[model samples]
Target: MPPVWDPAEAPVGDVGAALLMVDARIKEIHEPEDESEDGAEAERGELNRLFVASAGAEGVQELLDGTCTLLYMFMQWLRRTHEHGDKDVIEYVVPPLVATLRMMPRSVRPQTVPTMVALVVAAGTQVSPNGWRSQYGDWTPEEMNALEATVFLVAEHINRIAGDHNFAVRMIAETLTRVETDGD
Candidate 1:
């Protein structure tokens, strides 16, 4: 619950490097043939360690933002890649992430919605069973539907936190209007 970083002042290079390191670790964990099947606990531990290490860059706003984005991507990956019914790793990781998000400074908080959407969409596409393109004879209807639903849910949660509760609704309405007018 402590402030992750003070947006006003923090060493940009050091914090950025720390966040990148954590991201690389996350990538390693997700790599095929990299982590052992029985190492789920170890994977979660490593993620936790990275999370804490990133927190040490406290006061660096972008570092915190990058960390949160990476963690969310990790969650989306965890849900898709793992077949285990037991979600102990997710259960262990998300609360702290949520806490970290809530602790973000107002200056950086507005960016959360877009960041969540981007990461969620990226995660969904990468983890899609068939492929990223549902319209290209790749993804099944069910997979497309699931991906859409996941993106919608993540956006809604982010909008709620970012105080833009009607964001998606407004975006849909705007898009519909644009389509109706043929870009006029």
Candidate 2:
């Protein structure tokens, strides 16, 4: 569990190394300390406090902002480092990437959904022209369509949020745009 990105310094590094660092930290965050009930309860309490403390109505927005920034950084890492429309990217990279993206709380869904949309676009390109269901044995059309709709709604919500909070939205949107345009 080495530090992925030092909060003191800006986010800058080798993309592959950064991805590995972020993956490691996510694993560490999710890992169980002890199997005992007491340990589990303690862990839950600590995580809840962290979530709540960041999510408070007053002056605690930085905590939530920091978490969102890190999540966006992970998305930027993947988009900049990985080749789009590659089979291995679809198989190996996307599953864990999606899982990590899911770690962001629902409160930040507006900020995170565009990343998810980017992932879907990348992954969708990898599926067979006939359909993804045939290529990927387990996925159903209904499920995929539902996910598409959900992502669309989330993106719309992001637009709505951006309309109100232009400053924060502009910051994140610009970073995402830069990552998409610039190569590593």
Candidate 3:
């Protein structure tokens, strides 16, 4: 069973403030050791802790919902670029986004699944052009399969949430279409 979050104990405003404080502390902690390998490792650990804490806080689902909205906007941006033949946009964005997605924990991945799927769909569409393909070879078939699987898993989780069924289904379909198109 999932742990019940008590907003009475920690209100959403309090949680947001706590997250901001934690972020500030993390930055301060890492600034001095930015040049050292140990500092880098420590910074990573702090970041992981922050994310876990944020995800566990009361009203985190609301935060996730808001994040999903922002991600959707990013997806629209990607789609618009594709329609305009602006492949150069991805050259500046995809690598970092991909790296971040790859490093995310499976638990967290499910939380952001819709956003990830949207990103994949946008990327697949952009990559369909000959110029895009020449720059970044056809994405590996296995990668698309893995993303599809992830989308389904995330959809299952989102289905369990109270008000997210429609968004989940839409994201799942979008992701599946991209996976199929890329595989072809």
Task: Name the Cα RMSD for model 2.
Answer: 16.7
Task: List the candidate 3 regions with Cα displacement exceeding 4 Å.
Answer: 1-33, 47-56, 86-115, 122-184
Where does model 1 exceed 4 Å of error?
Answer: 1-131, 134-137, 182-184
Q: Give the Å error, residue 49, model 3.
A: 3.1
What C-alpha lDDT, on a 0 to 100 scale, does residue 134 get in candidate 1? Answer: 21
Worst 10 residues of 1 by lDDT: 1-10
TM-score, one value per model: 0.25, 0.31, 0.31
Q: What is the lDDT of residue 36 in candidate 1?
A: 43
Better of 2 and 3 by lDDT: 3
Residue pairs of candidate 1 with colliding backbone atoms: 5-59, 6-59
Tens-digit lDDT track of model 1 for 49-165: 676567564533344343333334434544543335554433433454445444543423433433434434434333321121222343232332233233334444434444665
Error of 3 at 134 (Å): 36
lDDT per residue, candidate 3, 47-140, as tens digits? 7467657767444443432223323333444455444775554454455445545665553453444445444444334321112222334434
- Candidate 1 shows a clash count of 2
Candidate 1: residue 16 lDDT (0-100): 36
